[model samples]
Target: MRTQVAIIGAGPSGLLLSQLLHKAGVDCVVFERRSPEYVLSRIRAGVLEQGTVDMLEQAGVSERMRKEGLPHDGFTMAVGDTRLRIDLNGLTSGKNVMVYGQTEVTKDLMDAHEARSAQVIYEAENVTPHDFETDHPRVTYEKDGVSHEITCDFICGCDGYHGVSRTSVPKAAITEFEKVYPFGWLGILSYVKPVDHELIYANHPNGFALASMRSETLSRYYIQVPAGTDVNKWSDDALWDELKIRLGAQAAANMETGPTIEKSIAPLRSFVSEPLRFGRMFLAGDAAHIVPPTGAKGLNLAASDIHYLSNGLIEFYGEKSSAGVDHYSQKALSRIWKAERFSWWMTSILHQFPDLGAFNARIQQSEMDYLASSHAAQVSLAENYVGLPF
Candidate 1:
């Protein structure tokens, strides 16, 4: 098989990349290792940055999102029985965020590209990359226990961190920066009603917790858990008790409960590999970097990668200009670093550090206080949270 571009994953990054390339009239094929149902049902990531929303709008995929996505004008931070609301809308001129899951994005993008049949192949497996240095890069994989090969002008390594794409780039060719947080997020999704309109990030002496929701009948919540925690030990009652304690009993009150749908633990980490491009193969999304979920930056950053790569590919192949393509790596890295910084900031501010002395505690309190009281501080958080222009 031959294509103008070969996308390695059907995650948000690869799917969106294919759609953008198609809009540019670039012939492309997408190979997804998982079935479409799995991609649409995988529950993760619920915040859409302002920049990501803009990209979706420009790509003409925002009709469903604009209609269904929950808009948040700000986020509330609670610590020591006091709540501080960061007025994002008042801070950043008319900027806002959307509380929608990544799974919905996969569904929406797939629906938009429904007419572009033969562009996506699901249940594909054993994806391998080869001859990326040549004009035709080869991506070989097996489908239904049969071997196959796909040839493209360029290969997008969007499979993710654990997939073949990142490892395909030699360790010597890639400069990596990574830090694993001392804690992880114990996430739960229930049929409970949400207690608040927008998200609340609560910081307590016990730990940090995030309160969010998926829809009117679904409440998605998270509590900071022990590093390397075991999910098996947590029962539905135990999980709800922990959440009630951390998020406050009042907020947890009268929250409906059903069969605990999804309960999983996610490690907090910041990972980045420099020079997201190599030869004819380019890396985008989770294949290039990962951020701790504190600031809700992971999926948004992946969207930004597609935004950059699609624009660059169009300029290179459409207008016959190599400028955007040549500068793609450096251009994407700038926004990546900004998000990394913001994610780290949110993580550190909310979590109580073990080594933090009384002075440090005071400082943290003062910082949070100023963020609530000062316009400049609110603007800084607003701009970072709503997102910086990509």
Candidate 2:
């Protein structure tokens, strides 16, 4: 098979890219290693930067999102009993965020693909990209008992961190920077009204806790736990008790508890692989970088990557120019680094570090205190939260 672009991974990044490129009349195909069910089953963050919401609109998949997604102008940040609302709309000049689950975004994109009969091969094994250094790049994979190959003008790796796309490149060609946090987030999804209309991020003596929701009736909550903590150890009631302590008296009073629909513990990390481009192949989304969920930048960062990449590819095809693709890596990394910094900063201020001693704890509290009192600090937080411009 031959195509203009061969995309690896059918996640939101790849699917959204394909949709944008297709709308621009650029032909592309997507390949996924897992079944569609498995892909959609993975639970992820729901907060959407204003830019991400706009991109979904551009892709024509925001219908459901517009109808169901929650829009928020502000959220509260708490240090023990003290709470300060960061007025996202006022600080960012009417800019705000949408609370929409990543899974729903994927489903919308997938539905669009299916309706258009876009080529997305799922459950393909041993997928590999070869000859990306040359103008002609090829991807190969096996399905059932047969092997197949696709030759394309370019290859895009949206396959994620453990994907084959980045691993295909020589180690010396890519520089990796990573920091693994000492703690993880123990999160649960339950069918109950949220404690607050807007999200609340709390830093307490016990740890950091976030009260969020997927919808009006679907609550999603998290608390910081030591790294390598087992999910099986915490019963639903036990987790709820800890949440009450960390979220403080006000939130605890309003909080509602229910049977958890899903539960998991995810470790925090900040990772970036420099030079997202390798010859004819490019990396985007988790394949290029990862940020701790503290800043809610994970999915938003991916959307920004798709913005740069899709536009670059569209320019290359529409104008017969290579300039956009040529500078794609540099441009994408510039934005990527800023988000990495914001995510890192959010994680640092909000999470507790046991080994850092009491001095660090006091410093964290002081930072929060400063944020509450200073308008400039609130503006900065609002800007980053609503997302830096794409």
Candidate 3:
């Protein structure tokens, strides 16, 4: 098979890129190592930055999001016993975030793909990109024990961290930066009303906890746990009990407990690979970078990557200009570093670090206090949270 672009991975990044390119009349095909069901079954963060929402709209796949996604103008942060609210809408001049699950976003993109009759080959095994550095790049994979290949002008590596896309690049061609946190987030999803109308991020003596919701009835909550903690060790009641204690009295009083439906522990890490573009192959989303979920930047960063990549490809195909394509790496990396800093800062301030001294605790408290009191600090947080312009 031959196409203009071959996208590896049918996740949101690849789907969004393919949809955008399809709308722009650029032909592309997607290859996925797993079935659609398996892909959608993976639970992920729900917070949506403004730029992500806009990009979904640009891809013509956000109608359900606009209809069902909850909008939050602000969130409350509990520092010790005090709960302080960060008014995102107020601080950012009416800009806010949308609470929509990543699963729903993928579904919408998939639906749009089906409507357009776009190509997505699921269960493509051993997928590999070839000759991306040359004028002609191609992808090869095995399906149903049969080998197949696609000849394309360019390749999009949208596969996640463990996927073949990033690994395909020679180590010498990419410089990597990574920091694995000493903690992980033990998260649970349940069918219960959320503790607060808006999300609440709590910094407690024991640990950090976040009370978030996917909708009015679907709650997603998380608490910081020691690294390598097992999810199976915590019973449903124990999880709720710990959450109540960490979230404080008022929130706990309003919180409802229910049978846990999904539970897992996710390690926190900040990672980036410099030079997003390698010859004719471009890495987007988790393939290029990762961030701690503290600031909810992972998925938003993916959206920005697609924005940069799609525009660059569109420019190249339309005007036959290489300007956007040439500078894609630098442009994407500039915004990525800012997000990385924000996520790292938020994680540092909100979570309890192992072996942290009393002096460090006092400084963290002072930082939170200043963030609560200073308009400049609030504005900066709001702007980054709502997302910088794409």
Model 2, 1-390: lDDT tens digits are 899999999999999999999999999999999999999999999999999999999999999999999999999998844589999999999999999999999999999999999999999999999999998899999999799999999999999999999999999999999999999999999999999999999888889999999999999999999999999999999999999999988889999999999999999999999899999999999999999999799999999999999999999999999988998999999999999999998888888887868889788888888998899999999999999997
Candidate 3, residue 37: the lDDT equals: 98
Better of 1 and 2 by TM-score: 2
Superposed Cα deviation of residue 314, candidate 1 (Å): 0.7
All candidates: CA RMSD (Å): 1.7, 0.7, 0.7
Cα lDDT tens digits, model 3, 2-79, are 999999999999999999999999999999999999999999989999989988988889899999999999998877
TM-score of each: 0.95, 0.99, 0.99
Best-fitting candidate, scored by lDDT = 2
lDDT of 3: 0.93
Once superposed on the true structure, which residue ranges of model 1 sit more than 4 Å away at CA? 253-258, 357-359
Task: Give the Cα error of residue 307 in candidate 2, in Å.
Answer: 0.4
Q: Backbone collision count in every prediction?
A: 0, 0, 0
Error of 3 at 371 (Å): 1.0
Off by over 4 Å in 3: none
lDDT of 1 by residue, 27-95 (tens): 888888889888887778999998888888877788888888899998888876568888889889888
Q: Model 2 TM-score?
A: 0.99
Candidate 1 lDDT at 118 equals 45
Local distance difference test values of all predictions, in order: 0.86, 0.95, 0.93
